[model samples]
Target: MGLEVVPNTREVLIDLYTKTLKEIQVVPEDEGYKKAVESFTSHRPKLIEKKLGCGQVEELIEEAQDELTLIGKMIVIEEKKWLVDEDED
Candidate 1:
């Protein structure tokens, strides 16, 4: 979507984004990785609203890193069913 990824020397934001997607293959049938995908995707619209002057890349990367990390953690849990349980309620 937008540029929510701007990895700096100390940040692995974009790297994490790609890695997360790879680990959790975002598909419709399985909501496991889907949950993480939604989180990463949710920021797309908001990020699209911003207008950066080439100085926002680092910040964007930092932000993307945070979002991607969470998704990565979700993948590690391997319990998408638990996430679904909350939705059922």
Candidate 2:
């Protein structure tokens, strides 16, 4: 018996990452907010590479990255929807 690897670690990280992204309320007009998002985006790849490991770690990283992009797009769409609602109200 050796060290036990936790199952679904990648999924857990993805959940947390997506939640964090979703909770961000920064608009595109703010340069500081853009830089903050950039910082998080820059670290995501390295964080996934370091924390999650399996036989096909590279493939896992790619999959995680794809999910991240989807999450980002979803956030943007939701924000736009909210802005429209606010304008209507």
Of the candidates shown, which would achieve the greatest TM-score relative to the real structure? 2
TM-score of each: 0.38, 0.39
Where does candidate 2 clash, by residue pair? none
> Which regions of candidate 2 fall more than 4 Å away from where they truly are?
1-55
Give the least accurate 10-residue stretch of model 1, judged by summed lDDT.
5-14
On residues 21-75, what C-alpha lDDT tens digit does candidate 2 reach at each position?
A: 5544444536565556556654675667675334454454455456556557866
lDDT of each: 0.55, 0.58
After the best TM-score superposition of candidate 1, give how far the Cα of residue 25 lies from its true spot, in angstroms. Answer: 0.9
Number of backbone collisions per candidate, in order?
1, 0
RMSD values, in order shown: 8.6, 9.1
